[model samples]
Target: MAVAAVTTKRKRTTARPTKTQPTTNAKLIKQPLPAGLPREWYETHNRRLKAMRLAIALLDTGIYHPANASNRRIRTAAERIGIHPPSETTCRMVRSLIHYAD
Candidate 1:
């Protein structure tokens, strides 16, 4: 008498799904205006005030001197002061204020 051969198949395991991390963009996100400032200040005046203050601070510290006039550095300073760096035309206005303040 010959006995029949028995065969067995192994069961495959499935991988578990992983949770994905949230992606963040480098663009600045808008924040609500501070309470001390008027609501309209965010729309019109606060940005200019912050930019001028930043520019004046740089001039006071000799950061924007002719020998070291760096638009990149100025932009960084403006950002630190919570103002988006001015466009070329607005930068010209900031520069004029800088000149007049000296």
Candidate 2:
């Protein structure tokens, strides 16, 4: 039985489906007002409180806070803040900041 199992080879007949990412239309997603912020704020704003706070901290320390920054968290925060998706350059900058953080 062991010899037969070792001699046998299996070939895949169909390709496995790759992981699909969730897509959301910025227009469709609901933006909730964060405490102390304005209703129209999301319309004009791009960054979230955490990102804004991080930006402030970065200005003082000249570094990003690792604990607060994550790719998903940043996107999620932005979605909550509203406006539209960030540019590729911005995303790259934020991700790079994460590495320099902590």
Q: Report the C-alpha lDDT of model 1 over 1-102, residue by residue, as the tens digit.
A: 234334555666955443342235334546575678777666456657655776786787676543353566667767766777766655655666666665
lDDT of 2 at 69: 54
| TM-score list, all predictions | 0.42, 0.28
Global Cα lDDT for candidate 2: 0.53
CA lDDT, every prediction? 0.62, 0.53
Write model 2 residue lDDT over 12-85, tens digit each, in one string.
99665443423343334465758787766764455444445444444354435655555555565457556344
Task: Give the clash count for each candidate.
Answer: 0, 0
Q: Any residue pairs clashing in model 1, and if so which?
A: none
Give the clashing residue pairs of candidate 2, or none.
none
